[model samples]
Target: MSPKYDDVRNSLLGWLSTGLREEPSTAAIFHQLCHRLVDYGFCLSRSTLHLRVHHPQWLGTRIIWVRDQPHADEQTVAYDVEATDVFQRSPFHRVIHTGKQVRQRILIFGPHIFQIYEELREQGHTDYSAWPLDHSQGRRHLITFATDRSEGFYDDEIALISDILPLFSLVTEIRLKNQLARTLLQTYVGPHASEQILDGATTRGSGVTVSAAVMMCDLRNFTQMAARRPRDEVIAILNDYFDLIAEPIERHGGEILKFIGDGLLSVFPLDRPDACDRLMAAVTEAYDALARRSPLDHQIRFGTGVHVGEVMYGNVGSTRRLDFTVIGPAVNLASRLEGMTKTLQRPVLISGDFVKAANCASRTEYLGNHGIPGFDDLMEVYALRIDAELHAR
Candidate 1:
């Protein structure tokens, strides 16, 4: 390692490791890259350090492009890349497809909105170089370093990055791919005005899900709360509440199906035999969450209902807008158990079906059968511990 390369060793290594680890957040990684680039003589008048982030979506077949902070131009860096005319072309596509370094220069003769060339020309930036980073998960990215040097990318400059490009490319690809999944989630799964906020609201039916254990959690007092609060506050509260339910779902190998106002509809499907066990863990988690979530202290407190049952999994909706949710008795039982929370007076309630399958006795108390709403026969249910008692044997 030569002295010139030594200046960027820490930054380059950090980026490489971050790429490998696929750190959920790239802000800190890119922020560090910006400072490190400055240390390595990438001093341009405008925001010189820029990153092109991309990932694969639509089942690892379609590529999605994204951009991260520290823009090349302060005025236009944070603008949407999809809205840019540059994205209309296949420049990024070609680079990712070939897995090679590529450079593109767009010259605008007339007045334009984001005159980056004009800004660079005024600031004396004439030359640029870039390398592609492709992760094995069908994700590709470009780590482009631009300089104002009239001579363009020098031999040593190109060689230095090229030498480490292989390692950086491997991790960069993963980082960007994971980033792509997240970007898609934030765009599609998030509560955006245009987006439906459901995970599989768009196209579905591409993948097959084996038998899965379905769990549904319906929030109590949501209807009353929504009626009392402002409209904007309702959305804000739902977003915060969903965060609580979602983190555990993902950790326990579950997917959030939808948010019916204050309640969260979720599923835990199992290809493995142990799939039913997650119900116990999730039940305990829900109770613990309730115990910690004091309305006076946190402004939000709600009960959780859980049940386990077998069901088929697939995309369920019309051609225009399809959704991914479970279809079976399991989902209904989960909902019934969730509603029982109000009558049971416990923050978390589980169905008898879940308790029998739980196979872990002494962890829960069987609540006798009782007539439930919309049900002809009385439903049998059970209640988990309030706190300090583990659901799993």
Candidate 2:
């Protein structure tokens, strides 16, 4: 390599390390790299990066940078690993499968090579090159660059890119690992709990006491339904019911901690200013689970209980397996209220404490104080007014 090219390569490596650490986002890093490459006389027109991710809804993310654009555009596509006809003809696919760099003189390559080549040629791009980046855990990534130039890239420019590929790949891999951890955690646990786990709260018995609104709900006849139906059918029914319960709670900022059998437990902590409002909203949303109609004309019903009090929230379990959830009298009270729903002939019940905390006494009907097991005093309960909730909105 020439001395000038060597200097540019060293500078680019230094910039990659600093940019990866200082910048807060992947797009920012991409923006900086694209600018630096142009400054190094690469005559870049467009660049694209594809990364495989572990997610339920998405297969991977694509980052695209175009000349003269202030920032990169990003998109996520569903994971479909096998090659389709389009992929078979893509230069990117060729580089990934062959594990080698693929360079094309766009003007010389006809439409028979790939449809994309014809489009790029029409768009004034003269050269295209794709690099297969190998990351940890056997995951492979692809990055492609295009230049619209008279002579395309010279031999030294390609050699400089080859020399700097390892450093570029290292920075990208680090960012992707962090992203994977975030996406997986958020998918499994709720967002707030995921943040705690990522912040290093993993040990058993690591917990904090917090005042919050707690909710517990379960299908009214799930046990009987499961017994009557096939296992697969029962599972599908349960998922549908759980989704009806979960969507509203999540939308209103509550985190579902666990699902035990047919029942789900969720909490809305009193940390934010509007916690009570959101908790009330989530309570109403839980009622959606009861109101859902099945396409098969099968009857599905549920009951919900809401209460507010101090509870221990955090990790609890064996050393090998830990569950991050709430524990205390508040959780028990919520469960008891849900059980009382069947006996009281009510679809939803709210503890007096939650009513008072939420300032919703006018929206609830008093259901006479009743004694609960393991508690000394009679716990006052109230029924949530579904009609009042609808009218109020």
Candidate 3:
């Protein structure tokens, strides 16, 4: 390589090394790298980085950088995107699936060329090339470059980019893996629990005892709905129900620990003075939302049980498969109360402990102490007054 080219390569390598140490996001790295290449006299008008990620809702993401733009644009690709004809005919699909580079000059395109090539030609781009970006464990992604210059990229420019791609891939993979870890953790577990696990709290039985308002929510008649409806329809109904119930809990600063089939377990840790009050607010909002959906063809109905007590919150289960959750008499009491909602014909049941902690005795209707399974003594329970006038308070 010429001296000038060698200097450019070294400078770009140093920048990539600094980016790795700084841990900037993948999009930032792509934007800076594209600008740096342009500054180094490369005929680059646009660049894109396509990365497949491990996510429950998305298949991958595309980061697009245009010359003179202040920032790159990131677009998520859904799981079913690959099945489309546009994807199958694009250069990205060829490069990703074949693990090979695709170089085409727009001026000499054939009739059977992909629609993207035709679009690029219309947009004044003269050349386009895509290459597989290989990462660890044989994972392959994609990188593409396009130029509007009539002469396209010089051979030396392409060679230099090829030489530096390994370093770029290494830096990006680290950030992508870290991002994937956080995404998956937050998806399966709640954000609070995910943060704890990420901050070196992974050992089995490693946890802390915390005073919290525990809430358990279960969908009413879910078994009958699932058995009667189509599998896909049942899943859709469940998702809709969860969205309605989980939003209020999360908005009130509660962390949902588990989604057990047709139910969920959550807690509002008493770190703040109004923890129990917040739990009540969440319960009220959830009930109201469910009520609003009564006019729908398939309305969703659920029961919620609330209590306040100290519980152990942390990892528990088999050595290989540990679960980060809460467990104690408090959680059991909450579960039992949820079950009692069916017999009591109430949508919400609050234990006496929760009512006392929340300081809302005047707003609740006291139900006499009732016999609870597995407990020697009867537990006092209360029901929220669902009247609009009282709930307005």
Our tally of clashes for model 3 stands at: 0
Candidate topping TM-score? 2
Give the best candidate by lDDT.
Answer: 3
The sequence of per-residue lDDT tens digits that candidate 3 reaches over residues 221-243 is 88999999999999998998888
TM-score of candidate 1 versus the correct structure, residues matched by position: 0.52
TM-scores of the models, in the order given? 0.52, 0.90, 0.89
How much is the lDDT of residue 174 in candidate 1? 54
Residue runs of model 3 more than 4 Å from their true location after superposition: 17-19, 108-112, 226-230, 294-296, 387-393
Superposed by TM-score, candidate 1 places the C-alpha of residue 110 at a distance from the truth, in angstroms, of 34
What tens-digit string does per-residue lDDT give for candidate 1 at 60-108?
2222112233342322233355455765444444455687776533232
TM-score of 3: 0.89
Per-residue alpha-carbon lDDT of candidate 2 for residues 213-313, written as tens digits (9 for 90 to 100): 89998887787788889999999988877887788888888888888899999999998677777977876765544444443545557778899899998
The lDDT values for all models are 0.57, 0.83, 0.87
> Worst lDDT window (10 residues) for model 1?
57-66
Candidate numbers, best TM-score first, in rank order: 2, 3, 1
Q: Candidate 2: lDDT over CA atoms?
A: 0.83
Candidate 1: residue pairs that collide: 135-173, 212-269
Distance from true location, Cα of 117 in model 2, Å: 1.8
